[model samples]
Target: MLHAVIMAGGTGTRFWPASRAASPKQLLPLVGKSTMIRQTYERLEGLVPPEQTLIVTNQQLVEPIAEQIPELPVSQLVGEPCKRDTAPCIGLAALLVSRKDPDATMLVMPADHVIRSRNHFQSAVKQAVEMVGKSQAEIVTFGIKPTYPAEIFGYIHRGAAIDTRGDSAPSYVVKHFREKPNASTAAEYVSSGDYFWNSGIFIWKAKTILDALAAQQPEMLEHLKKIVDAWGTDKQDEVLEKEFTAIEGISIDYAVMEHAKNVAVIVAPYDWDDLGSWLSLARLLGTDRDENTIVGKHLGMNTKGTIIRSTDDHLVVTLGLKDCLVVHTPDATLVANKNDEESIRNIVKLLEQRGMTEYL
Candidate 1:
């Protein structure tokens, strides 16, 4: 059987004020009518039922996530005591799903991405499942065709094409993985046309990932095993808080995928967006005639290429501002240049350093 594991533990610090510590971007209804996590789960309707789905998030967010995704039983919502990045997160989920069915194929994805065309997304998943079914050792991941030079996302350098059974979608043997590159390197990669933005979406058999972790990351796997052993015990929380936070925080790419021999990339046939930062709002929600993406009450005189998000009660007025980002929450309002989106993380750090965590 196939299982869906949604990784929803991220704090989304870049989208601060609205995306706070307790309620992150995945919990918010940033994209559409439903929350981002709900949108992600709906994309797996026919492919994987709610019963087989699992959501891994921060312990504090467990109840909030349960409210939005009521279809999944509360038990299926796994809460991590602390942030250990994706490696430990996925490793834990793999063990839990594998316990039910040793032959389980798990579809792991983030909760904060905006992906249209569920059919196409599910189709790619099905194709990856097929690819995995044929050879369970082959770890399958999706590669979104980069429309531009993106400095934010990691890049996947795809190698020679692989046999996709019948070539439903383009499949390739994995070559190399590049971390977030500089603007010049990103442009060079884009010009080469062999790179795709690492979608961070992966599909593999439970045994496959566990085995890979055992090989490439034995020490971390041992700690994860201890956590798994304490899964149902009274000391579950105590051990998770201790072991998970102590584990080396690294992504799956560094922990396994980059070194795994049998890896493949399937060029996704769906429209995918990570919605990583505040600038992403302008991309997801288009701009008006003034080229400003306004979410709520906003009256701009010459705010072009600016992203404004406010509430119904507050009306933010901007004049003579271009390529700026203005987000108005009842508690905090963000005003910064859109081009300096990366500095949002610094602002969050500053807030944390100032001990003004009330705004975080």
Candidate 2:
């Protein structure tokens, strides 16, 4: 059986005001009519069924996510007791899938990305799954061709092509994984065609990943085993709360993918966007004649190269603002230079320190 695990635990502080603690970016309809997570589920229509699709999110978001994804079984929605980053998140899901069927193939993906081409995305995922079925590769991850020297995203270096059993899409062994680099280093990576943006999407057998975790991350694996043993029993939630807290918060990339030698990369054949920040949204929704990305009703006298978004019906009027980001919500409003988009997280921290919990 093939299962899909959608990682939806991110707080998305960069998209603050619009994205809050209770309701994150994955549940917001930032791009199209449907919420980001709903769009993600729809993309897997022909690939995986709703029953096999698992959503791993925060405990607070369980009910809201269930309401948004009514088709998904409430039992399949695994809620984390606390934030444990991607390593523990994927490990927990892997254990559950392994419990169902040890040989099950799991497709791990984030719920917040905006993928434009659904057909191509499905084809690529199917290709990766089929490739994994026939090959000895333990894990397969997707890599997007770099469009620019993005300093924020990690890069995957492509190694030599691996010999597959049949005529399949080109797959390369992963040479190395590079963390977010400085501008000069990022430019070097982009200049070399071997580097691809690490999409953070992965596919592997439930048991295979478990084996790797046992070798590379023994402590986390032990915790996962305890949780898996408790499944279907009354002690499941009790074990999860205790063991998950003990598991260290780390990314799967650093814990397994970067260290594992059996990893491979499938060059993604679709348009992908993480939708990480307001700058990304601005780029997706191109600027108007004044070079401003405006979502709601706004009247600007001399605003140029700015991004303005409002949820309320109130008309926003700007005066002589240029290259700015103005986001208006019911409780909070953010007005800053577009260059300061990366510092949105800092602003969120400031709000937290100032005891403005209502805005967050």
Candidate 3:
């Protein structure tokens, strides 16, 4: 059997006022009418039922996420007391799943990403789950063939091909996991057909991952075990808050998968995007002849290769603006050169520094 865990704890600082502390990007509808998390959950419609799926998000977002994904019982929406990254989140999820079904295959993914072709995505997921089911110890992850040299995403090196299922996508033993590279390095990685942009979607057995966590992240695993022990008790919230915050914050790649043996990668069949920033809308919403992508009311005289987001009531007009990002919100508006997209994080930090809590 398979269980799903959706990691939706990200603050999404890059999205600014639209994606504030109360409502993050996952809760907001970025790609389509539905929220990102809702889209992700819907993508798993026939594959994994709501009863077998859970969401791990911020403690403050529990109510919002529950509201958006009402099919999931509030108990299944596990909220972290603080930010502890993916390792502890997955570890705790695996522990809880293993307690129910030790042989369960776990499908873990971020709630903010977009994956089209629901059938193809489900097929790929089934292939991954089947592969992991065979070995039980194999940690399987999906890898997207990079369209361009992406400096932002981690890369995975593929080894010899492993699984074959009636002309399905190839699965390979992952050779190495590489960090985000520089422009030159990224170009080199793209040139070499052996590397893939790590998609962050993973499938593995609950017990196997728990064992890996125990071996590689023992202290973290102990904390997770203690938290799980107190899951249904009166001390559930208190124990989770104390132990989870104390547990070290580390990515699954850094803490376990990078060191674990029998790790495999499945070249994904469906289109994918992480939607890291407002700039991502260019890829999703597409652009005009001038290469300007607009989601709402925008009138640009000379705007080319820019991304604009504004509602009907708040029309954004730009003159002589080329390759810029304009996001209009009721309280705060963001205007920046699209080339400096990474600096969006700086704006969030600056707001915090200036004690502008309302904007954050």
Candidate 4:
């Protein structure tokens, strides 16, 4: 059988007042009618049953997640005491699900990504599951076909092709993973035609991943093993709290996949976006012919290539502005040049430095 683990524990500070500690981006209806997390699981309906899906999130978000996706069983939703990153989260999910079905193929996905083509996305996942089922490979990640020279995203070099004979015909082996590059380097990657955007979506056998973890991230694997050994028993709470508290924070990319030689990449053709910042949302949503983007209630005069979003009932009026972003929430309003959207992280850093607790 197949199991999907949705990682949903991100703080989502880049979104600022719209995304806060109490309501992160995953739970907010920024993309469409439904929250990103709900849309993520909803897309996997016929491919994977509700019982087979697992949600790994923070302890604070457990109830909120439950309220959003009530179809998921209480036991299937795993929570970490703190944000220890994807390494521990994967280790925890691998341990829990492997116990139920050792041969289960796991599809690890972020809860906040937007995949436009739902049918194509599901077909790709089914193909990935079939591929992992037949091979000794421990892990596989989906690589999105690059549409632009995006410096904000990491790049993956594709190797030999995989037979994804679907309509999209996505192909690649992911020869190597590259960090986020400068504009010039990103342009080079775009011209080379061998680079794909790292989608951060992964699939693998639960037991096979555990074996890889034992080889690469041995110490972290041992820490997670203690909790797995106690699951379904009265000692689960005590062991989970003690072991997870002591575990170091690390991403699965650094701790496992980067070091594992048996890793593979499955090229996929789906309009995808991580929505890391408001700028990304603006581009994805696009603008009118006049180059004006408005969400919520807003009035614009002589504004071109500008994005205005407001959650409050108050009307936002922009005059003679071009290539800018204006976001108004109940608490804070953000005004920046459209080109400077990625630097909003600096604003977050400054808030942290100034000890502004309420804003974050």
Candidate 5:
């Protein structure tokens, strides 16, 4: 059996005003009529059934998530007591799936990503699952072929090929995972042609990942074991609340993937985007003939190469602006230069320092 684990705990502060703590970007209709999470779930239709799908999210988002994804059972929706990053999140999901079927394969992915070629995405996922089953690879990650030198995404260096008999999709040993680099470093990585953008989608057997966790992240494994033991009992929620917060806050990349020697990468044969910031959204929804991307009614005199989005029913007017980002909501609005999209995190912190909880 194969199960899907969707990680949807991110706050998405970069898309502030539109993405709030209660309703994150995953629950918003950013790209189309369906929400991001809904699209993610739908993409896994034939790959994994709803009964086998698990969603790990924050406690505050449980209700909205449940509402948005009613097909998933309430039991399958596990909420972390606190935000402990991807390591704990993946560990917890692994435990839950192991309880159901220890030998089951788990496909871990984020909810807020865009994949244009659904057929290719599914084909790549099938290849990854087969690679894990047939080869010695215990952990398989999907790596997107880099189109350009992008500094925002992490890089995956490919090593020697792992031959899978008669399988067309090539799999390679992960040489290493590198953090986001400078412009020059990114350029060099692209020119080398041996690197791929770390897509963060992973596949592994439930028991295999658990064994790896025992070796690399023993403490986290032990905590997860305690929770798994208490699951379905009267003390389930009680134990989760007490133990989840005690676990260290770290990412799976730091705690497991980077250290695991049995990791492999499968080149993703599809168009993908993490949608990390407003600029990414603009990139997806390109400019009109006037060199502007407007999601709502807008009257512009001299605006070129800008993105303007508003939720309320009002006309947004701009004059003599070029290459800017304007996001308007009922409560608050953000007007910034597109180059400063990465600084949205800083703006979020500033909001916190100024005690603006309502906006957050």
Candidate 6:
């Protein structure tokens, strides 16, 4: 059986005023009319149905997520009691899904990424499912074709191509993974043409990934074992809450995938964006003739290459400003250089210190 688990637990503090603790980026219509979470579910229509799809998010978000995605069965919404990071999120979802079907090949994807080409994305996922079904490998992550020398994203080096015909498409054994690089390194990687932007989307069978975790991260795996072992018993949820606390807060990339030798990379050709920070938001938005990405009602004067977004009806005017980001909400209005967009996370931290929870 094939199933998909969308990890929607991120806080998305970088997109502050717009994305708050109560409603994060996944629930907001950042890109278009629908929320990113809804887009993720819609993207998987033919690949996996709502019955086979699961959404893993924080316990606080369960009710709101359910409200946004009412089509999902209540049981399919897996909630984490605490923020245990990606390792536990993945492990918990895998454990729950495996309980229903042992042979489940799970497509573990993030809920916030914007993948434009639906047909291409679906084709790649279907191919990866067929490939993983036959292999004993533990994990498979999609690596987006690097369109530019982006220093923000990690890179995946492709190894020998699998023996598929020309129509076989771009699938490769991951040679090595690289952390975010400097400008020179990023340019070198882009010039080589083998490096891919790590999309953080994964695929693997439940048993295969569990075995790899057991091998590479025994401590995390042992803690997860206690939860899985209690499945179907009356003590499952209680045991899960307790035992999950004992696990370390680490990403699957650091705890397992980076160390596991069987990891594979499926080269995804579709346009993909993690939307990690405000800079990413500004970069990926649509622009008008004045070269401004205007979200709400706005009248600009000589504003070029700037993003001005406001939920309110307030009119925004920019005078002789280029490459700027202006975001206006009821609580706060932010004006910053577009080049320094990633620093918004630091601004969020400062707000937290000042006890500005109302604006956040």
Instruction: Give per-model TM-scores.
Output: 0.96, 0.96, 0.98, 0.94, 0.96, 0.94
**lDDT of candidate model 3 versus the reference:** 0.90
> Candidate 4: misplaced stretches above 4 Å?
163-168, 353-355
lDDT of each: 0.89, 0.88, 0.90, 0.85, 0.89, 0.84
Q: Name the 10 consecutive residues with the lowest summed lDDT in model 5.
A: 162-171
Please state the error at residue 356 of candidate 5 in Å: 1.5
Looking at model 1, the pairs that clash are none
Q: List the residue pairs that clash in candidate 2.
A: none
TM-score of 5: 0.96
- Residues 119-194 of candidate 3: C-alpha lDDT, one tens digit per residue: 9999999988888777833888999999999998999999998848667898888999999999999999999999
| Root-mean-square deviation of every model | 1.5, 1.6, 1.1, 1.9, 1.5, 1.9
- Cα error, residue 30 of model 6, in Å, equals 0.5
CA displacement after TM-score superposition, residue 17 of candidate 4 (Å):
1.4
The segments of candidate 5 whose C-alpha lies over 4 angstroms from its true place after superposition are: 164-167
lDDT of 4 by residue, 1-360 (tens): 899999999988878768877789999998888999999999898988988899999988999999999989999888898889998998899888888888888999999998998988898787777677767345678887788899889988888876655563565666788888999999999899898888999999898779878888888899899999998899988998999999889888888767776666777757889988887766788878877878888888889988888855789998899999888888899998978876777888888899997887
Q: Which residue window of length 10 is worst by lDDT in model 3? A: 129-138
Q: What lDDT tens digits, residue by residue, belong to model 5 across residues 1-360? A: 889999999999989879888888999999988999999999998889999999999999889989998988999899899999998899889988988887899999999999887888888888888878886688899888898999999999999998865745677999999999999999999999999999999999988777877888899888888998999999999999988888988898888877788889987778899988887776788878977888888989989988999855878999999999999988888899988888888888998899998888
On lDDT, the leading prediction is 3
- Model 1 spans > 4 angstroms off: 165-167
In terms of lDDT, which candidate is stronger, 2 or 4?
2
Residue 67 lDDT, candidate 6, scale 0-100: 92
- Clash number for model 5? 0
- How far is 146's C-alpha from truth in model 3 (Å)? 1.0
